[model samples]
Target: MTGVRWILMPLLTSAACVAQAGWIDEAELELRFDDNLPRGQLKRDIKSDMAVAIAAEGGRGYQLTENGRLTLTMTLSATGYRQYSGLDHVDAGVGLAYRHKFGLGPLAPEARASVSATRLEYRDDGRDGWLYSAQLGIGKRITERLGLTATYEFERRKSDDVADRLLPTVAADVYDLTSRNFTLGGDYTLSSDYVLSAAYTLRDGDIVSTTLRNLPIFLASSAIAEDRVFGRNRYAYKMKATTRGASLGVSRVINDHSSLTLGYEYIDSRAEGGIDYQANIVRAIYLHQF
Candidate 1:
């Protein structure tokens, strides 16, 4: 938590120095279904599940200059999983961001940078963690109806280190993870009230996989633990992996301050020692801004 404080203290101080004050608030509810909730590598280990999450955030933005703005946000969220109750969690986070426009006009290129820290508490103690992230992005409005964005992000997660009694030497903090990823996204206005969105992402990092006991994964794992979320006999292993994914979505504006979105995402991950997995997710989200 000390590291998280060092990153956020400066931003909090800047908020007191700001002369401009404008509040931004938003709330969101999401329902999702995952065909591979466990990130399982074997068909026998795959566990499908559905979840619901709700979140709210409020922020203040300061126009530091004609083309630069700084914003700070605080957020709270909770999620409930239908089958994997251990994955249910509550999260609280704070974010600070800055954006600058290179020139005036709707077509001007913009650059953004942000940092955030979140604390997540799970029903299962082993999954409890702190998540930290930093990102840099660029965006441009190519036309009145089209916008594009690209971003690179670095993330770190910290979690409990509960060692198995039999494998005391094995690392047990499977949720303590680190990753770097790049994303490209675009949005096109289809009508006055509808938007079409798409995104592609490439990620290289550590991933946790749960499956029946196997020698290949057991040998490659940096961390190992019994994961009751899937089944009593299932075990979780942490391994280095690379993932590529894409998403497609459509959103309908309900009014000036609300919208509903339906989306689908597919991800393929390749881990060490010839292990691989794929996941398909369907989601519906509703958001309102105040």
Candidate 2:
């Protein structure tokens, strides 16, 4: 966390060098509820939580000689989760983008890249880790009210405990892995005060399955002696999986600074060790932007 602070200070200081820098341009506060907090595949393993988050972002752009602008933005967010507080974290990100306008009104293409870091603190302290991600995306506006975007993302997460060492029969079950994701999204404004959004995502990566309710069969398959080493509820296996999901949301704008969104998401994941499962999530978000 200290290192991140040091990095952000210099970026904030450098904003003064740009003419169009809005040092503190926009801020947002959000409240959200998730029916499946850990993205659990099995219904029996699902847990629910509510989160409150606050974020602030600022940007600066330089006008190009042609019809484009180069921009840099910095964003910071802090969030707290309750019901199951172990998944609480803070995130910070910085992005750089280029936008080209075609002289035709309301038509623009943009390309962007960003890097972010997250630190998770858990009450149990077993699943805590630092997660880092990088993303690249491109978007184009087809009309004044509609836009489309495609993005590719990569992430790496490293946890503190070694699961293999804790359970000898498990095959290197450490909760550290790399993942890749590709997403296509679209948004349409139905009116000045309402917007509808949808997205589809495909992700391939490694995941840890912690809540195996059928402990005896799972243990026998892994060639491990039945011991209480994993306790009643703990992560037991690491496997490669592919997850595909989609989301739909409708947002109603209350004013310039406030809005409400209702969303639903569905995901199906297939894992290597017969841990395939599906999950559905419904959430509501209340956001205030300034």
Candidate 3:
């Protein structure tokens, strides 16, 4: 009887230990490399840029009910860009994500929202711009490794000097723009370490500009001749454009805390009632998790 009691006590202790162990939380520090290889009309006139970004994020699970759980995450990123013409810029931003899961049947619904702000400075021209964006998304998981997500986003941009400063003649041509975008996407997770995804997006926006210095001599003279010249000769112009695009990508988890992704994107834009413009982009991203 004494030997049996000893064996039973050990078995009970092991069970208690197992019951106390729960899922572990995750935290990581990520460093990312973004290479924007440009193709199309802008390729010959503009140089491509490279950016390095770093982020730190953590996630923890909370019990919502007997069979439901929520995961909350917050992240901050700093990105710096270098252009081929020796131009450089830096931007910093923050974001938050929340995911909830309910153990009902085979599908789980999730929602997410994020916002960020960026400041861009041109090293050669001493010019800068501010850009801000917010996005919200809702999605459902079809399986542990597959899902569909739909999102809406709004973005606004303002710039100080986008055109050549030396050519103040065209400086008035520099402008600011605001855009609103809607997108739908799906993700297919092949495994714990690999995923493939695609998305279609539509963007509509308007560009606004004010006079920088003065109108060209010919236009100025014409205005003067017409007796419509003001002291400053200021003018405003508005342009509207629509863009549609698709992206395809694959991501691989290199290790417990690292990932690499490659993607291709195509975009077609047309000025309101104008000609169409096409752009192609190839990008490679490396992320490090700590």
Candidate 4:
């Protein structure tokens, strides 16, 4: 009995120490400004309309163990349209995440899983929709300053048209779509205040459109020809799209728990049977910790 108590006392003390070191808590707020103000292929002269958006997000984190953490985030955003002439719309989203770390000798690996729900409402059409997504990822810490991550994501969107007149008399038109994406990316930390990142993404989905119209023969024929040739119609279109993008940025650490980042991203996307689109975006982000 004496020998057993001696062993058990030290073991219990060690367990208590580990438990005390296991838990952590953190919170953060991020604000971003984006101006999709048109240029080049997105030019207002050609597209004739542009959207400018400002978004803000807040998150809270809880650590379950020394190597595992969970986070919850919420976002609210709005976009103003130019040339299209419509009231600004509000968008909101919530996300939950989990991350864990493991290691093998000199190599360290991290795994992450997340789920999110988003809602968007438009004032002009009084149309609203919901989207849900799940993602899984694994990453390796190549070095103290560099790491790589690979991810798979699946998303589904459900939308109902607010204009009942737009539905066909013979059949109801309810539109829904599902999209899946695979992505790989790498990140490098240049210094305590700067970082660089790049990513490539592939996406596959089907988009459905419905149109209700009464027109003469010539107009109808023209519309059909345009849809067939230009790939615009009231039907379901299956598509595979690929996007290649890179971002270069400098981050200024405001304090122990805050940062401000300015970055530029260039993206090029091509679809199987549709016109290619290219975009360049400049963004400013501010982060706060609590």
Instruction: Judging by TM-score against the true structure, name the best candidate.
Output: 1
- Across 140-174, the per-residue lDDT of candidate 2 in tens digits comes to 88898999999999999887664335455455434
TM-score, per-candidate, Cα-based:
0.90, 0.74, 0.60, 0.63
Lowest lDDT 10-residue stretch of candidate 3: 222-231
Alpha-carbon lDDT, every model: 0.86, 0.66, 0.53, 0.55
Between the candidate structures 1 and 4, which one is better when assessed by TM-score? Answer: 1
lDDT of 1 by residue, 150-200 (tens): 999999998855646348678777788999999999999999999999999
Question: For candidate 2, what is the TM-score?
Answer: 0.74
Candidate 1: regions farther than 4 A off: 1-24
Of candidates 3 and 1, the better by lDDT: 1
lDDT of 4 by residue, 1-290 (tens): 23223323443354345335542122222232323222112233122233444455567789999888999987665555544323346667899999888954334798999999998765444335787899999999799888899999998876655223323332222234577888888878888877777677676653322122223221212111111111234222222345566666677787887777777777665554343446666666665544
| Global fold similarity of model 1 (TM-score) | 0.90
Which residue runs of candidate 2 sit more than 4 Å off their true CA positions?
1-23, 39-43, 62-70, 96-104, 121-124, 160-164, 169-173, 213-232
* Candidate 1 clashes between residue pairs 3 or more apart in a chain or in different chains: none
| Candidate No. with top lDDT | 1
Lowest lDDT sum, 10 consecutive residues, model 4, at 221-230
Minimum summed lDDT over a 10-residue window in model 2 is located at 220-229
